[model samples]
Every structure is written in C-alpha cells, then in structure tokens.
Target: MSKLNIDQKKIKQLFEDKRSDFLIPDYQRPYAWGEDECQTLWKDIFNFAFPDKELEKFNSDEEYFLGPIVTFENNKKLEVIDGQQRLTTLMLLLRVFYKRLEKMKDENSMRTKQNLAQCIWKSDEFGNENKEKLKIDSQVALDEHKNEFLEILKTGDAKDFKSQYAINFRYFEKEVDEFLKEYPSYFAYLPTRILNNCILLPIEADNEKTALRIFSTLNDRGKPLADADIFKAQFYKFYVAKNQKDEFIEKWKNLEILCKEVFSKKDNTSTDEIFNRYMYYQRALKGNKNSTTEGLRDFYEKDSYALLKSDRTFEDLQNLGSFWQAISIQDKNYFDENTLRWLFILNYAPNIMWANITSVYFMKNRDEQNQLDNIKFAKFLEKITAFIFAYSFIYPSVSQLRIPIYSAMIDIINDKEMDFSKFLFEKENLKTFIQN
Candidate 1:
C-alpha cells in the first residue's frame, strides 16, 4: 500500500482534458465482457445518478467511487495497467449520452455535445490530424478487434460489428432510450453527476513495474473479481513486498501461463468450471457438503486466502490445473497405464457420475505419485466406475436404485474410514455397488 502516487479525481475530469490518451498494453487481455457485466454496470450507474426518490439526497460535490485506474505517463499517452474494462465501459456510456444529446435539439445541445467530445477524443489540430486517443494496443491476433472497438465508438452502430464492445454499445443505447421515456430530465442531472460527483481514482506510477505492483495491491472494491485475477495481483505484490528472488516470480508466472493455455482451448473451461471441480474434490475428501460456485468462492477468499498465499500454493494450483486439463482434453499422461485404461472404460460407460469422481481424485493426488497413492487411487477409481456400470446394468433406473446409489456415494465421500466392500457388489451376477 505504501508504494503509490494516488489521485482522487472525477470521471468527467478525466475526459474533459483534450490531452488524455490511454494506451492499453499488448500483454493485456482483450475486452471479454458480455451482457452480464454490461447489465450490472448499467444498473449501478442508473441507481446512483437516476435521482430516484429512494436514492439518498446528496449534493453535487458528493462523489460516488467508480473504482481505481492504475497507470503511468509515457510521453503524451497514459499507459494503462488496470481498470481498462471499467474505463472502456464508461466510455461507451458517455457515447450513448452524446448521441442522445445530438438528437434532442435543446438550447444546451451544442454545449453538452462539446463537453462529451472532450471526454471521448482530443480535437484534431491542423498539424496533427490523426492522433489516437484511448489506444488498445493488443497482440496482433486481437488487433482487429481493437480496431472494431474504435469504429463502434465513433459511429455508435451495432451493424457489421460483433465484439462484446459492439453488443454493449447497442445495449447502452437502448437502456438510455428507455430511461428518457419515463424521466426525460434524468440526463440533465446525469451529465453533471458523472462529471462532478462520479469518482475515478487515477494512480500514476513512475514505470510499468510500479504500476503493476500498485495494481496487484488494489482491493478493487465494487468491481467484479475472478479468483485467478485477484490471486495474481496479490501474489505479485507478495513477490515484490517480501523481496522474493526472480526465481519464485518466474515459477509463479509459469503457473499463470499454464492456466491460460489450458483455459483457452475450450469455451466451457473457465475459472468456474475448474475451480468447481477443485472445490468438489477438496470438500468431498473432507466429507463436507458445500459444492456450489458461491460456496467455493466464499471459501477461497475467506478461509483459504489467508492460508494459501505463498509460492507453494501457486505450484499446487498449477498442478491442479494440469489434472483438470488431462481429464478435459482426454490426455491421461498423469495417470499410469492401468488407471488410464480404467478411465477409458469410464469414459465409454454411458454416464458421467464416476468420471466426475475420478477427476476429483486426480486433482487431490496430483502430486502424490508413489506406489501406495497410485494403488489407492486406482482401486478407488475402479470401485466407483464398476459400481456405476453394474448398478445401471442390474437395476431398471433411478426408480429401483436411485436412493441407494446416491446415498452410497455420499457416505463413501464423507466417511473415508467406512468399509468399501460392504456397499459395493449388490447383485449376484455382476459387481454392482448398490442394492440389487
């Protein structure tokens, strides 16, 4: 927290300056926000500035904190290290207001347009006509999307545009149009609220390292948080704060890179999916019943955050990623040949119950590769898979075997000391695991 050069400024103040140019670095992720994020942000702003009777009466001088933007000045442009997502979304909002003002033909129409222009772009000078403001300098693959972003901002058209930026732009336009329907004068107070009452904490650092370090330390109150994002920021701050050597930082980075690689291969394999599986395995081993996403997120930030903030935690999470990746991509290099063959049968077994359980076991024992661990894991894997298959083949469906099958799985997960053979092998002809 000590390493900072912070400034408390308003959102309007940031855009009013013609010289303000923000440069998003190449390493930064692309604008991946969708309607879920956009809707949430819209609700936040409307509730704050809508002048509803229920909203607390406040003065124009009162500021609503929009969150922080960490960056450093590089020549004339500001190099953005964090808060690009929020800033970009706000810009889209301003554009919607600007467009609305142009169609109104009111006495303050020209003045309002002029003010909105200052927040969006710099006036073109005779000597330099094509200056870039709000630059999203992304990797080559994402470069075209950034270009499309600039185009949507300028034209405010959703046609022929397909990125999340375009979709959110149209969404704002509709929301604002709807707002004007009931409370026509909302914009009159809204613009001033944004300029004078809405806050933007712009922290200026001396270099990229310092900016990133500051970003890592930020709590990001009121903003959407992913476990991986916060974990990276916290771990980076720890690396610098504790004066850990470069070796540790490098290892931590490899974990992040490995996660990105594994996550990028599919659409459904994001943080929630992987983290849910990890949580299931952890709780299942301890016989705990909490397995929902909210449960896992709460557990991570509350109990696990304080305990696992170290180099070793980074290694463990990365290894867990590898375990999930193996199951996801159908690669069994992490398991021995016998276990791999067992997994093959489970995969073709026409059900996913046991496969899910086996994936959790792999995640928990990812590092425990000794003979005993292997033997226990394999037996555990086979017993579960074979029981599922046998139970299905012997009984009709959940009608005859639902309660026993589910109850056994629950008891087995919760009571590790319980006998494995007693509940398994229910039918005489086959190796069933539940009541025949």
Candidate 2:
C-alpha cells in the first residue's frame, strides 16, 4: 500500500524551485484549453486578485483555489497524471506575465519578473535563471508539441496561433494588455496576485499504479477515458522498469500516429481500435472461445493488466498497426489486389468480428518482409467474408456468431489447416441464409 502525499500550495510555491520539474507523459491528451476556458480562468483570477477594492493592498488571507494536479515521482521528475491542462495553461499565463514585465524596469516589475522566472525555469543559487531548463515538459505525441511549448515560453510569442499553447498564450497577452490599458497603476500587482493567491492541491502518489487508480477514480463521473490510455500507462510502467522508457515512448508515438491515420473512429480512438482488434487475437491464442467478449478496458485490465506487461503484446500490436495501415491505404507493396478487395467487402459486413478474426490471422502469419502471404490471405478473406455474411443472416443476433468466429480465430492462431466447412451453416440453414 503506497502512501499519497497531499499538499495544497500556491501556484508560485508549486513551481518556484528546481525541484518542481513536471512531465506530462506521452499518453495524455495535448493542451486543449480554448478561449472560453482561458476567459473563465482569467475572469475568476482577476476578480479574486483585485476584489473590487482600492488597489493599494489586498486582504492577505484571500486565496483562489485552482483545483488539483495529480502526479507521481519518476526518475526525479513529477510525472503528471492529471491536471495537465490547467498546469499548462498556468505556465502559459505566467510566461505571458514574465514577458510583459520585461519591458518595465520598476522595482515591483523586476521583482515580479524574477518570481515568474523561478516558476518557469531552473534558477541558480545566484538567482540567475537557466533558460534551457523549463520547469515543465509535456511529452504528448503531436509533432513538435513539446518544442512548441518550449519555444513559446522561451520567446515572448508564437506566429503559429494554431496550437493551443500559442492560442492561450496570445489570449493571455491580449487580456494583460487590455488590463494594462484599463488599470495602468494596478498592472504590476496582477502577477503578484496570481502567483501568491492562486492555489492548487497537489496529489502526489508513491507509484504509477496508485496515481492511475486515483486518476480513473477521479474521472469516473467527469469525462470518459479511452481504454488505450490505461493500457498505455501499464506499458509505460513496464518499459520504465526495464529502463527502456525512451524506446517505448517513440514506439507509442508512432503507434498513435499510425492508428489515427489508418483506423476508423466512431467513439473510440484509432489506438483503441487496434487494441480492440488485438483483444480478439489474444482471446484466440488463449482458446477461450466460449467466453463472451468483454469491454475493451475490462479485457486488457484482467489480472492486474497482465496482458500489457509482455513485450510480445506490444510487438504484436505494432505489427497489427502496420497491417491495418496497409489495409487502410491499400499498400500494394504489401497486400495484393484480391486481398484488398475481400477486405473491402469485409469492411461492409454488419459486424466487426470478421476484421477482428482477420487481425488474429495476420499476426500469426505476417512475414518478416512485412508482406502477407497474398494467396493465402486472399483465400482466407474470401472464405471469412462468406462465412460471416452467412452466419449473420442465419443467426441475426451478433452474439450468435462469436463462438464460431472465436474457434476459427483459435485455429488461425495455431497455424492449423483451417476447415472452413466447420464454420459453415448446415445445408438447410445455408439455403435459408442465401434465400434471405
């Protein structure tokens, strides 16, 4: 049982020292704050900071609660599990203030600038800041995402306003200028108020498991999390334990990009789609065809997330991602025309079981050259298509097709000479299936 270290601290207190380095892992969502969220935060903090009183002195007891951040210590850094959006937005806001203070040489302005610098960068004993070492890092998989935030923080602004980092930073700048225009005398106090008054509850867990459990429990009613996020956390833990965390991060980023490009998304992410497909492959390997399929999270989370801890699981997933990408883009270098045609037909099938079964077969049979056994693949697809359609019409209910498909998938996994006839309907049922 790991103990959680819970502490409530002011915003400046959380990030004012070199000890406060924060890392948002690769699996978390990128910064998503838009104008509305920034506006609401700005309004609340500004009102709290000013209090509609004479600007000379604010009540020392006044504090604005800025919610909580969940993190665990990893390799001497705080790996953020939750509250990255707020953490990121605050950094942008603070950077904006730091940049604004640069133009003013007044004692208050310079002092506020120094405090903000300590929050944004690693400072020396002499109070000089190391611009190279930012206090926070977001490792989200978007291209140049981490660099973009760093660049925005190091420099005053960004030309590419497309990023939420840039957008929110610019928004804060605009809000700051508007405030300066309205209250020139009070502008210097704004940063002080925000840094000293804004508060965040820091929930630090002793391990990633505890951190993730806390994350899931907290978000149960707030926002639905994708199953892939939990799986990624498990993989992160496994890879980190092996000292291969950097390698895993790169592979996971590629997986994210590939899945988003190649897989279909209804409600789930492309990563989720890949996992969902691979779940069938695992089921087949276990030869547990009789058990009903479970929800994606529940399936992967069995035995304390035992499935994701294996290196083979992730390797198979990478191969599966590549296989699906080929199918999606019709990569002629790897897949023949006949196979693609059958895959097209299978895509239109009433249920996704056909595709899931095909994923299992691909994992078992895919060659080192990354090419499918084209003749076998085409033949397999044709048979599976016919079998799935026939079963669909005869059974009508989706669950009725699972046991047979699951059995066929097991046979595929074991490299058995598939007897497609075993999966076919009886002659009378076949006649009824075709007639309908």
Candidate 3:
C-alpha cells in the first residue's frame, strides 16, 4: 500500500538495467502467447522498424508501446504479477536475435549482440556479460517448461520441446531468419529498432498482495485469464505448502481435461463453467440462496480465498466435474435412460436454473456404483422439470424461479424431502396454459 513506483522505459533501458532482474512468481499463470501473438508483435515491430518511406527515414521519436508490466520487489528481484506473456516472448525474441547475431562477423551485428547480451543476461561488476544466468525466470511454469525455457536461452536449442516457450522461440527464430534472408541489409537494423524503440511501462508495487489485486483487475494483451486460473494458483499454493503439490497438479490437470471435453464454451471456459456450477453447490451448503450471487472470483476470493484453501472444496469440485462430465457424455454407468430422458427435457428448459439443483441432488444422492439413485433421481428430475416448465409459464420473468430453485437446492443439499406445496402448482391453469 505504499506509494507506487511507475516508470516508462524503452526495451534497451528496461533490459540493460542491472537492477531489474525479473521472476515470474509461482502463482502467476504460465506464458500463454501463441504463434498469433508472436506474429502480430513481429509485424508491428517490422512495420515500425521499416516504414514505407525507408529504414533511414524511420523516426527516432516514434515508439511502439508494448504495454505495462506489473511487479513487486522480492529479494531485489521483481516478481511479475502481470505481463509475463509479453515479457517472456520479448526475451525469446531477443535471444533469437542474439543467436543469429552471434554467427555474424560484422561490427553492427556484434555490437547489437553485446547490447542484447546485457539485456538477456546479467553483467559482472566489471560490465562483462554473465552468460551463466538469464535476466528472467518462470517459477510459475511446469518443471519441464522452466527447464526448456532456460535451456533455449542458454543453448538456443529447442529440440523436441513443444511448450509455448519453445514454440514461440522457434517461431521468432524462423521469422528472424526469413527477415534476414529477405532484407539482408535491413536485418541488423531490426533488433536495434526493437531494442531501442519499443516501450514498456513498469508499475512496481510495494507488496505482493497489492500487485496481485492489480493483476486481477488488469486485462492482458490477450483475454484476461479465467477465474479458475486464479483459483488454480491458490490451490497450488495450498498444496505446495503441504508438500502435496504433485498430487494436486495431477488431479487438477485431469479435472481440466474432463471439463474441457464435457462443458460447452457458450457461456464460459469449461473450467470456469464447472467452477460456476460448484460455486452454486457451495452457496447451497451455506444456505445462501436468496441474495444475488457473487461473481465467481469474488465468491472464492472472499475471506482470503477460504474456499480454495480447503482440500474438501477441491475434492467436491472434482466430484462435481466428474458428475457433469458423465451427464454430458451420457455415460451409461452414471444414469439410467429414464433419468437422462428427464435431464434431456430440462436441458432444453428456458433457463439453466435446473442445473445446480440437479448438481446438489446428485452430490447428496449419487451411489457407490458410480450411478445416481435412479428411482429417486428420476422422480426428482421429473418433479424439477415440471416445476421449471410450470413456473416458466406462470411467471413473468425467469428471475422469479431463482429463489424457489435455490431453496430446492438447499433442501437437496440438506437431504430434506421435496414438497412443492409452497409453490402455486395451479393444475387447471397449468393444463390450460400447456394446451395453449
């Protein structure tokens, strides 16, 4: 909460500064810029470096804004909270330029390589380039990914590596090589233009908490990460502190795969969708159904992210993900035809109010055979479907169904028997309305 330190620096000033080592914190999302982003960046800088007038005519005052990087100082190293994707990609691009330059005997290429070396690696007290270390590292990524990235920088070899880091590095390699071949004279000028003209704004916070809050609010150059992405970091920290991170990672990846295959992207990412469904189940457990629902991030993040800190919450999420995956794929082991028939009807219902209600029921009622309590589940689905359809007609707005369905969800969570006596049923009106 201390006063912020904000500064704008060109790539040269930013990377050549000895005080500015960077670390992608263990909680940050992995580098995710794909080939498209790399290409877009290359094209932008290419156009900037080689304008229609001529490379010699390029304006020194004109700068390509690369965007902001948010970080907090940790042990003299800046732990990146946001903008790791751009920063990482830029480093890869710089390394590609360095590798190509290393092979050239020209004075311009060697001078550019020296500047870039200081950018990519730390210099000794005497200002000699230290090839042993890189200026940035990613603790957030998988071990293999971490190793691959460092290896690429140190050796310029990405053989047999398929991670985004490796892929993007190779992409830059190809682009740089082609640019060199296509415009041999202008090729050396490319890195100079990029290193000296591209602008990156750095926002250094006084603490990690404030930096993360900033990250959650800021959108990346690409899509802001899903709420589940933030939640994953919390879960990862919790498990790692307990020395159970490997197990958690395995389970988390499996859950991601299941949700990706089962959930549609119409509303949100598959992981976010499953999280939303599980949030409803959590709300039901707390007997909180009447008030407006909190956003997926706000709900888990409240009370210092108490929900994600618990093993129970993660287990329940995995269970709910599995349950939905079964339904989505219509796995015969999970539900009989009769229940699925009602499920099909409810799926087409005017609102998704039935979904969480079904989730709560299944969680409380599913059996050891990986099947629903078929008779009870069928009857419950049938009743819920009838309630939804009847209410859809009788009510003027879909919001009117929220409380009743939420109430039903709570009842199911508490293992209470359903009785719609409090509802308007209106059998004659319902029948007449249905007929029309």
Taking all chains together, each candidate's TM-score versus the true structure is: 0.52, 0.68, 0.83
On residues 1-436, what C-alpha lDDT tens digit does candidate 1 reach at each position?
A: 3356777888777766564678765445567778889898878766777546333464555568988898888776777778888888888888788878877766665566667767776666532223254333332122347777777667766678887878899898888888778657545556656766789888988776577667767844423334544444455555656776355556655655565666663432254444545555555555554323244446556654663466655555666766656745656555677866776677666554564455455554444551225567678767777666676776646344434433444565554532345546535666433434
Q: Which ten residues in a row have the lowest lDDT in candidate 3?
A: 216-225
Clashing pairs in 3: none
Q: In candidate 3, what are the lDDT values of residues 312-364, reduced to their tens digit?
A: 88988888888888788777777798988987788798887788788778777
Whole-model lDDT per candidate = 0.62, 0.84, 0.83
lDDT of 1 at 185: 56
Estimate the TM-score for candidate 2.
0.68
Check candidate 2 and list the clashing pairs. Answer: none
Candidate 2's C-alpha lDDT? Answer: 0.84
How well does candidate 1 score on lDDT at residue 134? 38
TM-score leader: 3
